[model samples]
Target: MPASTREAVRTAVLADSDTRWKWGALTARRITPESVEPTGFVLRGRATPTARQLTETGVSDTAPREVTGAEFLREVRDAEARGEGYDVVVLALVGGAVRALLQGLADLGLARRPVIVTGYVGVVYEKLTDGLLLRHGADVVLANSRHDAERFRAVYEGVGASAEPVVEAALPFLGGAPHTPEAGRDTLVFAAQPSVPATRAERAYVLRRLVGHARLHPDREVLLKLRSKPGEHTTHLEEFPFQKLVRELDAPANFRLVYGHMGEVLDRTDLLVTVSSTAALEALHRRVPTAVLTDLGVREALGNHHFVGSGLLTSFDLLDRGLVPAPDETWLARQGVAADTPYEAAFDAARERVAALLALPALPPVTPYYTAETAPGYLPGVLARHRLDVTAPEPRESGLRRVVREAARGAYRQGVQRVAPVIRRLGEL
Candidate 1:
């Protein structure tokens, strides 16, 4: 595709309804053309059919309603057509769904061009899809953390790809805020997505360590905070259903089981525990005592916390003492985490690096089939392999249905081709 044509496809995908629904908050709310400053683009939504627009528009509800597959396809097609005009498309779903959705879109003839796709950690589908999109025609992939960024690179570097660490739209806690530690309570907060790999086994070990420690420090309390429920991404681990581990520990009346925001929970927390999570960085930013007990590779790549004496390779030793040891501030400073600052300078520095990395011409294919000199080299292959057959529309449907159908097929096929390598590698590992 020509550069202009590629730009058009990206514009359509970003404008797709699914992108808006999943990543709407991050993309549309934070990074829209309007937010870029000076070159703000005014968003122009397409006009609805007169008769359809005339139907009674009801008040919005808190609960989200599900869209049927047909409706979903139609919305994507609309977005694909619109993607050509936009620079980015933020996918809000988990990594897995994002991957599948991309394939689905490609199957409908909507190519993953020009637009960038961004998403969060909980959306596993988003993770998978974002990588695929990068490999195909996406200009950039935005990851939530350095850990995630490195992970993305390890998985999809060969695919037309590069990732930047853009902190997701999280609670802004930069300014110094008073957070009273959950004093006298021997609590460890598990704030990451419960479905993360090896979560249960890891949690089990941590819990046993905590239980042993609590018995030693009878005065201290141990609180475990869990998600409301197991999300779709949670595969192997059994969640802390009804705070099961809390009850099973059955140590003392002082022990508490809590749920909700880590920032809020951290207010009363003496210690934070996890295998490898972005939350540990959050905890360290707030000066919360933390311990790293796993060998998750990204943690190794990112390096360990210098604050408190706890190393990335440390055991759950604090739990043995029923105490939360303050981190080694000297070590933390080396990692660029400051005791005086409320926000992490390390993260800020990482963002700068990310900006530089993104500025580099994304690594092109060995054959260089998609550049100015080779614009037409693969155009026929793209069109021939991407053609979609729209099912004949009924009299009740508008003529645009055919366009929507074809777009969906093309987008999905493009997704599969892009993500196949990542999927194969994942299976092998």
Candidate 2:
């Protein structure tokens, strides 16, 4: 309530590295940790062993602290009692964890801490869960484009929340020095998503379409760029990974399975093809011609509603027939990528929001719940059942450590084989 007691927090979430870094730098100007916890980050959900999410974001594996739901409430209460309550809590959660975390906080009688909800995925407003969270829990929600901000405003009105919090912030990762464009190379990158081919049947259809497309355009290079390795558990619950499917294909020389970051992959991509994956947005940002294969449509599991109205939406059949479409200028204008807005202006817009948010008085305490109003339907059933009742993941060995451990085991097996005859003779004696 007082300027002396004002505090700010940014949850050190794995998926929110850009937001965390941007806000962390902005807040350092006005708020210092010694004065009043400038950036007090709390752990939210558990990470899968194969996820390696934290490592991917450059978040340290050390110093992760855990607290039960009730314990969390006590911490909030304790902070308030000691006159050190946080003024703002920045949230950039990737999944339903935000709702689960919010529900727990609400149950504990959430201290008047304003929550800022954000997302990195484009066309996420396609999911109603975000609208529900914005309406019920979040005081503010960041939008990457004026188009998305308007959509967020519509959702807020739909849920009877104020549109004032739906503010425009440039997509953080879209900015930076442009790499050498893959123009003239005629390279087609199939931004392989786990969602496009959710089942084996869908997988077969998409792969067949891609290979067919490549055959028609033999001069072009077709790369199946995977989001993760064969077994990594990403946000997409992939049943049949494309990495595994490549082995069965009667592959051409140009057909290759590439593993790496989307940014790195985009370095050489000329024409980007996808089943309405957000990678299209990256291709757009990079000024590459992208085509959204509406072959799957919005029905069943292959939902690509985000690419609606974007001029790039095409059919896999069209690609198979060797027809490439250009991105719509109107759609590009609507997206408001870094190219459209000056980098300094976009960066400043985000920083200004944080500066103004933290300057506000402590937020009114909230009564947390676990219904659709609190948690989005997108959350895991197990997580929904245990809202706020969560456990933090213990830090684990890095991928390198795991590889070293496996190598040592292999060496031991070879040594044991060499001594097998001697052990058998000793046992007889």
Candidate 3:
């Protein structure tokens, strides 16, 4: 059902709460106006509850009830059976979730539909997910920046994944909602990443560093932005709870842990710091003068190396000195962050490409549905199967036992974090 005219492109958006809230809404608001009725399917991956949480937090202002993978497949089959079809399907999710949906489509023999896979975040270093969309039959793989598009082409092509349709697209989240100036800009906002710190000790060290920064810069307000609280499930696990850590430290008057929308924070922020978070990119795009803390430098898991020379990517030295660093022109240029604007240039370059791809010819039908690779499975089973080669199975455990196991793991992590300081000293010696 490829439409040469823009008005005729009926679309389906498949995404989770955050992706839909952050990205898919951007698509609906920007690409498909009310004139274009686009259906939406929630990517109910490993967690159904989290999706509900996203909605409760207002992830999708106009989102419908999220459906499961089985439900999504059933709808596709039913639609095809009725000889009804959509012009395009939009995918917006991180690694495995995106992989599962694409494979599911291949299984249903519906891979021939024109599809656009958009990026959810602006990643810094290697995420270990390569040639993902191309290999799974996406007609267009969106790249949010020039550097990202360059990397996408290299990685996808290197893997022998067809390089035909990887196109540059403006970051979906970049458009709309212009920033309003806030009061004073002496606020140092630390975007917390519970998953970044490996061990309990590591997590403590990170928090203490923030505390130390607050203590050093008493004149400045230190705000800690947490992605998830104690019971919530975010992108990563909370190995060491920051709330727990805060109680242990004798914090300064101005130092406080906080929770709010990033946009609001950026409006008032003078400086943004993180280990290696996509938030830094957002801050930089907003011209908020950001820093990437490299205290734990070159950690691939946290994707820290990605910030190596990003001028504002700093150590604890500046924090200790009560200093805030501005974005480096060379670094910003190298990262392809625009010189004047707070947004990435590639995002603007991509607008037409996405619209054009939607107008291209429809994909060929998967003549034989359910290949050995695409056989249907539940979300958990599908994810486990797809990760077979790379990820080991997590031993089945639940309830208090699972919590106890995580606690033990956290204790072990604490032991390691304690040793990390010594390890650094010994390495220097």
Candidate 4:
């Protein structure tokens, strides 16, 4: 087929959360040929990014369409029936959701379907085997680092499944100028996570430590870089937010909660600290001085255990003592930070892989490892959670009812995210 005869590649992405949306949209754009622009769809759910959250991500062009799982499937099926199907579809969803989508796609039984692509949003520190298995059917299951790629392949091959889909790629969101000493003011940023230090006591302790550090060094600016504000849903549920915890402490003017793009915050930052946020990777990629806190103990629950050999782990005490640690070069190479390598070239293999898959006559049905036969007890529950039942016909809805349903869903999300939290806090009081 000649390029002129064939229509341009049509790409679409479906993501469940804001962070996943960022990863999926950017990954789609990167893998797609330069001439094509990918469309983005936000899956209607609790974790769906608000307009403000999406804007903060800086992925402005796509203008994501919101869709329920059933609606998205119907759209894909209808498009394929019309012979105008998307060429590529990226599933930036949770593992169970990805599994459900795989089952749904498999059931569609289209003669031709989009080349499915899926991957993590960032440093995958937990649920290694389970997550990988759920995403096994994607045409390309991107591994965000060389370290991840190896582990992903090992998990699949160990389980007697094919590891062909795993592709080595750097995090799409990792980029910015290398750090240089700021002329006027020096900044130190603590990249906060939503639920890592899940308990209020733990979160409050961290906040008090940050405030203490700020009081100790008022001249050097200290920032608590928060992921989301109250009432805003992110990739994870923030049961105990740093914002509320900080209000209890008397802090210097230099210590403040700032929210926006993490890369932008890193720009002015002389030192970046975190328990285990992916922002640490971003900071390290920029060659900024970074530290992983051991004050919480190098525990798996906190996720700092993932940084065991990074040579960046330290306590606030060490930081207070003027300790600045350099990242181990070998570890950086394994993690695909590749400070010496061209960032653009990181996607070369992924692009080539996508191009090759697209060139095939027609992709076979998505064959996930956990079929009804393989995972009889567990498979149905996963599909049911997403409201995906391939055995039954998709429900029909009137336009008026759909409008009402979407509106209701929005209200429900707001109540859960905003109203419920306040009510709970009041109850506590």
Candidate 5:
């Protein structure tokens, strides 16, 4: 298609944190045609990424504009009223936020609106029903795997809701050169999550085990690939950071905290280890030797249970003893990490579904499962948490007031990252 004649799909992605921003932006690019580019927006909140965190993802060349839920909704409504609105809007937010936005959009009652897209950033191990229902109203509720797609449809269908919007897709960021043994150094990377092993004790135990492994193998390079720095936030809260825990332990020179793009780190990695991070999928995609830690036990809380039949679950003791496990092909197929499937093809169904939606005369109002009429008791609280109300207009703030509010938000984030941790530590003493 010629540049002039081609339909330029104006895409917008709203994400809450660094990881979600990366996932949403990449997903927007993947689902759209090659000729179109996607714009990104970071939802201003506690989980908002720091400048460093955004830069480290390496997903976007430019920084995304940050907006509150009301601000974003107003922008979309005003744009549509002006006949210059986005063609696709990806909501990379938590379930409540997504639900709030759906209500907000429904309240707009526009003759035509953007095709809203939403999905899990990674593995859908917990809150499956609640999250899926909250995202029920999107034009396309993407499932990162065949496993997820089935589960999503079942939930909707069970509730007697339409499952037409559920689309099968793979994690957009899954790609890298197949792992090859390097001549000089062998690297082991433990992909860390923010809140998986939620307690301080569990996190400390994992850190000790990692340090012990590093001590046992002095020659091999070991890396703690953290999702975010101590002050910076990702998808989840980090009550206990590995960076903080490592300071208490005696780690060797070969084992250090390295932060950068995961793919770049995987390029030199001989083994990839994680409790239950989506990084395991990326590693398996690249044929990298990977392990899902069983040392912490195969518990749902830790999320390692998701890999139970995958053949990647093992303990640090086995890893120290030179045991390298290969993933089961059947399990990989179900997880959308099939060796034979091309990554490019993963978004075909989504693209086609989106194209058809775009071709329609007018799209209907966003109708989430939890509405004021259906779930009178539940819906209000969800909307209220994000400060969204379908019954009233969102309040507009003056420029000076906006500046002061942003400054206050910055201070609050600083306290959460820096001061609060210190206070907690002091309390412990």
Candidate 6:
């Protein structure tokens, strides 16, 4: 390909706040507009409302561009005609839609050479489908964790495709000035929202255990910081039996509900508690002692047990035995998680892998970008209640938008309500 032509063709296949920010900051590639015909389109399997929200807020060119199944099939055909046009197709997808998407891609002959970023592991069908995609088309598959990376590597051993870890760090919003730590407060927070019935049962059991432990140690305070989500004020709050539990038991004076200011809430807590939720990872990495509540069968099935089995996780069993793993003092001293090499080195390695995928006669590299200024309809705008230009207002905000802003408060209340009864009941146990 000629230099000028290659440069002209190197536009982003998908343009959204995250895609634009992630890829744009890393490389000079412009976010592809809906108006412009791409050499080929890249599709992610997950219907990530957040990604769509990013696109809705930040992506320029407001024309309504509806991509139907047929239109997508046509785009692939067009790309195929312009041979050597697309580096490769990429799909970061999961669940039922994956089959239809892959089948469609295959029918169009687009699945012959592409890259696939697989989601979490353990679902056999999803893993097998991902492996098949890799063998048939993918040049590179991105895993979000070291465990996920190793899992994918095992699945596709000896296959042409390769797996690499891309740890999902919290966005810059999380890095805002760390609040001052709260001293001498003995609180434990369960930050996850259990959406399923089975999960609720497990959570109930864990709360019971924690309450029992709290009763035995009357000197210590037990605080529950529950986050609220969409429909939470109605469903979760109403269904959870906090008030009833309080009425039933001779409650400890220290057991109270704390909400709001998550960083502060966490700072006050002696430790964080959860099932197989990512909050465990966040808490430990940030120097908070973490306990994995393993009695939850659902969480255990989802690989929470592995963390407990690993030295990294301190289990509820240990906590019941009066154990508390010290905070990651090394990371706290350095003010960051451990890396054998510096961040720049890890980034360099990531860039090399991305470059390798791009250089492959098969797939285009994902160039991620971030800018300090707000673009039209960008995330900052949506979150801040401003327009894309960072000026006007939209009529309504998304449910998720509301949730992220208010989750800590809601979760804290719910956790207190749910745990109070269990604590009182522990005497019977």
Find the candidate with the highest lDDT and give its number.
5
lDDT of 1 by residue, 67-182 (tens): 33234445555655764223334444433334333444445554433234444432222235333332333333444434444555665554443433233222222223444554
TM-score of each: 0.51, 0.70, 0.75, 0.93, 0.93, 0.50
Question: How high is the CA lDDT of each candidate model?
Answer: 0.41, 0.56, 0.61, 0.85, 0.86, 0.41
Mind giving the per-residue lDDT tens digits that candidate 4 earns over 141-198?
9998888999999999998989999999889998899999968878999999988888
Error of 4 at 308 (Å): 0.8
**Which parts of model 5 have CA positions greater than 4 angstroms off?**
1-6, 389-407, 418-429
- Compute the lDDT for candidate 6: 0.41
Better of 2 and 5 by lDDT: 5
TM-score computed on alpha carbons, candidate 2: 0.70
- Indicate whether candidate 2 or candidate 3 has the larger TM-score: 3
Off by over 4 Å in 6: 1-90, 103-116, 121-136, 145-147, 158-181, 184-186, 193-200, 210-270, 296-302, 312-322, 326-337, 360-429
Clashing pairs in 2: 106-368, 112-363
Give per-residue CA lDDT, model 6, range 114-155, as digits (tens).
333223221121235334332322333444334444555665
TM-score pick, better of 2 and 5 = 5
Among all windows of 10 consecutive residues in model 3, the one with the lowest summed lDDT is: 386-395
**Which segments of candidate 1 are over 4 A away from where they belong?**
1-28, 33-65, 68-70, 76-88, 94-96, 103-114, 119-136, 145-205, 230-242, 245-247, 294-313, 322-429
Tens-place lDDT per residue, model 3, 1-429, is: 455554455667766545344565455435542226567676543322243445543335565546655566566656766766555566666656666666667666553454545554556365434424323456656666666678777776675556556666555554224344456647888888757866667788888888888887778899998765554545444546688778998998998877655666677777788888777777776677678887776677777777766666678886677566666677665555544555544444455555665555765442222234444443455466443221223345579896795566455544543444457667978
Q: For candidate 4, what is the TM-score? A: 0.93
Residue 429, model 1: Cα distance from true site in angstroms: 27
